[model samples]
Each structure stands twice: as structure tokens, then as C-alpha cells.
Target: MVAGTSTALGWLLVLLFSAVAWYLSGQRRAGNKRGKLPPGPTPLPLVGNLFHLDPREMHRSLEKLSKTYGPVYTIHLGSLPCVVLCGYQAVKEALVDQGDDFSDRGAFPVFYRFTQGNGIAFSNGEKWKVLRRFALHTLKNFGMGRSSLEPRIQEEAQCLAQEFQGKKGVPFNPIDLVCRAVSNVICVLVFGKRYDYEDADFLLLLDHFNENFRIMSSRWGELYNIFPRLMDFVPGPHHRIFHNFEKLRQFITEHVRRHQKHLDRNNPQDYIDHFLLRMEQEKQDPQSYFHMDTLVMSTHNLFFGGTETTSTTLRYGFLILMKYPEVAARVQQEIDRVVGPGRPPCLADRKAMPYTDAVVYEIQRFISILPMGLPRAVIRDTPFRGFLLPKGTNVIPLLSSVLSDPTRFKDPASFNPANFLDKEDAFQGNDAFVPFAPGKRICLGASLARMEIFLFLTTILQQFTLQPLVPPAEIDLTPLCTGLGNVPRPYEFRVLPR
Candidate 1:
């Protein structure tokens, strides 16, 4: 109780001091305009441009800002100057061509508070290098991009198909269904096992994940990132983000503890087991990055990232399919020809099914999940697009700019698979199709995610004809909310067995 009270007092002080800082910050923004930085709107004191940005849709706000200020511009988040990199040129120059210098994860208050730089997604410098390298090596050994792990995905795909089939042409929301399938895949990799779909405990855990995504993408999450100390003093659903993560952390810690009791160094069954083995090996090194906190956080990272993204992607993809029945028909036709009822779809089938592959790419492109993309910080004082970005400045690689760039994608505003196809109708890919931002900080599980999305999508589409309860014309494609992520509004659809 004392600790809670003390924590509350600390936040109150932070809020009070921050209010003064916010006021002074507004005065500083006018000076920033002439400071030789990229041109942007003059921010108000203390609040900076906080009120200028729409909390419900930051990507849209950032995208709109880019229109006036040019691709490379700066916006102040509170007193901090965040450089916004819009369009393909700005994003690529920073994230890809200048990858290493811009590789460090920019500090977002919510993730910083949650991760504390302990895991792959939010860590930086040598710590990020070590965790990322080890994770890649371990993932490779576990058959991330290789053919060896295809069967595991195929198995889950089959399970998902069965679950959908069991719904018996009745209307149901696919969010929870796909979340379970996706999260359980990470469970297999992290815990060395899968959860029973009907297990009461597993269902409860999934509820937490479902809520976390909703809250994290909601306005509450955005406000937390902007005014953390202030929000820390107050109470709202933003607090639920931490509560949910705590539950997830507790769950991960319990698994880690359980694994510690009977871990086999010689026969590492999963990511945790492998990490445990690595920790033991690095025990003698004082600067070792492999430790229990890293394990717990990284484990949580995989489970959190591994689930929400791909699951939400698939969920949104299906929603799109339901919206465009003709597109769905074309994909089904391609899938039926390449992968018949006799066999399930595999990664290899991706090559054989051009139309279906295009649909998958288009889904990712249209939705543009992580619309603003993950934030990156300048590693050092750097020259970029004719401007000097000082070290430690937070950067926004506006992926929405790339994915929806009118110059790159012919019909950027529309959902058309041909954007990823050609006149010859072969499966094609575009550099602008960077749903996973490129560079040193590119998604660690990109391959795994790709495999799951393709396999799960094909598996389900192959078996069932997804139809919205309402006519496709009536379906709304606009996201319900979009701050850090684009969350599709809830809708109902039915699965008719093919």
C-alpha cells in the first residue's frame, strides 16, 4: 500500500513538473522553426503539437503533416522533436540505405515503460545487436525460413480450418478464433508446446491478448505515449495496457520458471529452452546480454508480436476477402487449381498460386498495419535528405507513406492485387511493399509471419467460402481506430464449406 501511494505521489510530481515543461516547450517550438531543422508546424508551448495531432488517427495526422512540410519534417511530441520521414524516399533513405545509423528503436513511452530495453523490439546499441543476433540464429536453427518448420504451420493451419468448419455456416467473429491459432504458434515456439483451444486457462490468456491489442491501438495508448507522466497520475483504460502486460509477463515468468526445473541443455525444445542454454553458457561473461529479464521480455515479445500482428493481418485479410467476393473467388480459383482438397496448402504452393500470393501481399499493403511503422532513433548526429538530424532524435519512418505512395503503387488508395502482379500475371513483389519495415530493425520474425499468413490464409480459404452476413457492398473497410496501429472495426461473417 505504501509503495502504491509513493508511486502515485511520484507520478503526481512528474505531472506537475511536466506541465511547466510543456508550457516552456511551446515557446521553444517557435525557435525550433529557425533552428535549421526541417520545416514543420510551429508547436504550442508545453503541449507542443500535441493538440495539433489527432489522437485517434496519428498516421493520418502525420501523413497530412507531410503534405505541407515535405517528406522529411519534424513534429514535437511534447518537448521532444520527432523527425517524421514520409513517402518511400524519406523512409527508405533512413531505414534501408542508412540502416545501421537509424537502427536504434526510438523511445516510445509505453513500450519503454513495458520493455525497459530488455528485448528485441525496443532495445538498442550492443544490447539490441546481441539479442537480435541470438534470436535470428536461434530462429534459423529452429527452421524459421527453412522448409523444416513448414509442417508445424501446416498443422496449425489445419487446426484453424477445422475450427472454422465447426462453426457450421453460422455467423461468428473471427478475431478470437485467429488470435488463438496465431498465439498458439508462438506458444509452440516459446513454451515447447501448444495450448488446447478449449482449455479454460488458455481462453482466459487469449482474452488478455485480445484486450491488449484493442487498448494499445486505442486513443488511450496514444495519450499514454504522449503524456505518460500526466496519465500516470490519472487513471483510465491506458492503465489496462500495463495491467495486461503484467499478466502476460507473469505467465511468461511462470513458464520460464517451470522450464528451469527440467531444462535440457542438450535437447532444447523451444526458444525458452534455447535461451536458458545460452544464459548458462554466458554466465561467466560480465557483459553478457543473455539473462532472465531478457528471456522473460523476449519471450513476451515473441508471444505478443508473434500473435497480434499476423493474427490481425489474417483477420483483416479475411475481412477484405468478404468485402470483395470476386477477389476472393479469384484467389480461391488459384488455390483450388494449385492445392486441391486432397492436400493442404504449403509455402511451396505460394509459387504455384500467383493470384493468391498477390491477394496476400495486397492485404498487407491495403491494411498497412503499423501505419506509422515502429519509431527509430538516430544513432548519432547524422546528415539526412539535406538536413542535419542530431543524435537521439526520435524518427518516424512513415511506412503508410511507402505502402500508399501514389507514385509506387498505381492504385494506392484501392485494394487491388495487380499492384503486386504484372501484365504477364505472374507473382511479383515491390520494394514499396514493405509491410515489414526494412533495415537492421526490420521485424525479427518476418519469415515466420509470412509463412503463417500464407499457410493459414490458404488453408482456410481452400476449405471454406467466407461470406459476410451483410452484402459485401455494405461492409466497411475503414479501420475503427488508428493511432499506433490500424484496427479493423468489428464485423460478422460466416464460413460456408466449399
Candidate 2:
């Protein structure tokens, strides 16, 4: 019986080796068919270059690899080979110069599993184009970036400030407050109304969103993206991501259903109303992208996109201000001079408040949120820098490298507003300051996000000064984790009346 068991184990070992050999030979043949590609560390049979990467610090790991392989190189995530574009020039050349060719969304299994190629973010081709255009139009119609939306944001900011005042100078983590305030802005557009800050259901939904964003930015999420099929059978926090998504999905679907019942094609109230109208218009068209599934996914895209990054930025920005009191003071001085606490900061005040504008821009650059940016893919076979990328090859544009490139910024390591200030102390924009990324597929809510960040942050400062629990020098700006997002370390602070 022992001899038989040994014989069976020997046969299993032989099969494993045979599979590896077959995969390698197949890779060789494919390499011959595809033209020259950038060289990088050799990958193993099935795992590819997974070992070479530090899953926790994906952006830094990719940057380190760029040191040896130059700006553009190829690294495999499992069997999938993604071309990495590091530094500003390479990234700009590919994402900007050859925008159309590399305009497609790459395979992001984690999000795709939930979205199923239905939303604007994960979907590709004409479906993406249609949904994106429709969503943008709907958001604009609902006053997304225009002056009309200012009242909604200003009202929300005032609510946020009053909420802080209610804290009575007690120390507290501002995550939920900031998230709710930021989310309410999108809530107005998507759901047609905002929620009370203490609303249990709304708070629960925010909790799930926060948890999902944290987990999706964890090592488990990175591993899932690389080896999704394998990670499915394995257990970890990554599973929570999908579970949280289902909760959000159910919430959005219920809202969608409510809108469907009160559908008025003439007077569409919000995003859901607009989408239901579109679905009715396209009901007869079999090829139409408008459907119940797409509406839910698209609404999820706008709601999630609107909330997460902007709130995270505010949370991180507040921490930075606490760390550098002098910078915060300077911003407050600018605010006092311009807005003078008479009203909330407006977009029109931006040009006059150069220092505050510089500070805001600097904060975005310093954190480098979405460090690796979203993955991209080539729509068709394209040649980049004498190397041909196949029709569907995945691409990673390292935005962190661009933001922190020595060639681009004088001192990329430190957090200095001077990086964005010119000789005359005027606000200067940099080509590399693309926190929203640049291309046809740039974030749909980029303009609105800019407005919210500026208004909400300035409003908070206008009402109170952020007092850190620890000394300014002792405050650490290091992120808690870095994956899809650079999550700032958690801390509690008191807001003294300004």
C-alpha cells in the first residue's frame, strides 16, 4: 500500500513538471509571435512575477523595478503580463500621446466580479463610452460642476462644520463625519436628497463603503487582482469586499426600484430618474446599453466614485494640516483675507486665494492618492517605443512616480506648497499634477471633486483650527496601507473654534 501511494505521488510530480514545461514552451512561442517587448525579471511558470512584488507597496515595488528595467517594462501578474509606465515622460507619452490606443480598461478582476463589465469604470468599448457620456450629461444637468451645485455643497459643508462644533472640542476621529459630508453632495445628485448625519441606514452604508475601500486597498485585494481565481478558494478580508459590495448593491437597487415607480420622463429629478427615463427610451433597442443592471452599476459608479476619493483626500489633508500647523495657519490667513468667514469658500475665490489653492494642489500631490492609477489596456496592437504591445495587453501607469519624479518637482519627497507656487507666489499648474489622471477616460467627476475638496476643506478651516492630539512634529503622515488607494493612518483630533 505504501509503494502504491509513492507511485501515485511520483506520477503527480511528473504531471506538475510536464504542465510547467508546456506553459514555458507556449510562452516562448507566443513571445516569438509578438514583437519585441520590454525586458524585466523572469517569471515562474504559473505565478509569474508575484514573488518579485511586495503586495503591500505595489506602487513602490513597481517604481523599484523601473530602476533596473527603465521607464517602460513588462511584469506579469500570474499569467497576465502588464506593461509598467514609470516616470512622467513615459506615462504621458503612452496615456496622453497614444491615448486612443491605450484607452481601454484592463482586467481588474476584483471590481469586474462585482460590476460584471456593466459600469462605466470597468466596462470597455462603446458600452463604456455611452454610459460615461450619459452619466456625465446627467450629472451636469443636475448641476455637478456648475454654480448651481454650489449651494448643495455649501449647505453640506455648513452642516459638517456645525457637526464639528457639536463635538464640543472633544477629540474624535473625523472619518465618518467627513465621509458623510462628502457623500451627501453625491447623494443629492444620485438619490435626489441628502441624509441626516445620524441616520442609521446612511451611517451603516458609509461604514460598508469605508470598509470595502480599506480592504480593497489591502494586500488581500492586490493578491485577488493578481490571482483572482486562486484567491476565490482561499479565505481572507478580500471576501469582505464582495460582501460589502452586495450590501451596497441591494441599497442602490431598492432606490432604483423606488424611482421606477415614480418615473416621470418629462421631469427627471436625479441620476436614477434620468436613467429610468433612458431605459424606457431604449426599451425597444436590443443593443441599447441602458437597462436595469446598467442603471444600478452606473449609479454605484457615480455614488462610490463621488464619495470615497474626495472624502479620503479630505481626511488625509486634515492630517497633513495638523502635522504642519504653519501651513494650515497660512491657509487660514488666506481664507480670512479673501472669504473673511462671511460665507463658504467659493470657486470664484480660488484665483484670488493663490496660497490656499497652492496648498490644496500640494496636498493632492503629496499624498499621491491612487498612486498606481487605474490599469489601462491597448485597444489594438500598438507599437510603443519600438516595442509592440498586443491588442489586449494590460498597462500600469505609475502616477506616483510622475507626481514624485525628481525631474518634475524640485523636492518631491517633502510636502511643500512652494512646489505649486511660482516666483510671484501665484498658483501654477504642473503637467504632472494629474491626481485625476489625464486622458479621454479621466475621472468623470474630476471637476466636481475639485470643487468639493476645496469647499469642504476651506469651510472646516474657516470654522475651526485642527488641533492634533500630539505635537506637530510627532504627527506621522505615513499611510496605513497602499494598494488601490493610499489610506492615511487613523488618528483623533480636536477642532478648536477659529
Q: Model 2 Cα displacement at 29 (Å)? A: 14
lDDT of 2 by residue, 99-194 (tens): 999999988889999999998898999999899988898899999999999988999999999999999999999999999999999999999999
Model 1: runs farther than 4 Å from truth?
1-36
Best by TM-score: 2
Q: Which regions of candidate 2 deviate over 4 angstroms?
A: 1-32
Error of 1 at 478 (Å): 0.8
lDDT of 1 by residue, 54-125 (tens): 888888898998889899988987667889999988788888899988988886888789888899888889
- Report the number of the highest-lDDT candidate: 2
TM-score, structure 1 vs. true: 0.93
**What range of 10 consecutive residues in model 2 has the weakest lDDT sum?**
23-32
Backbone clashes for every candidate come to 5, 0
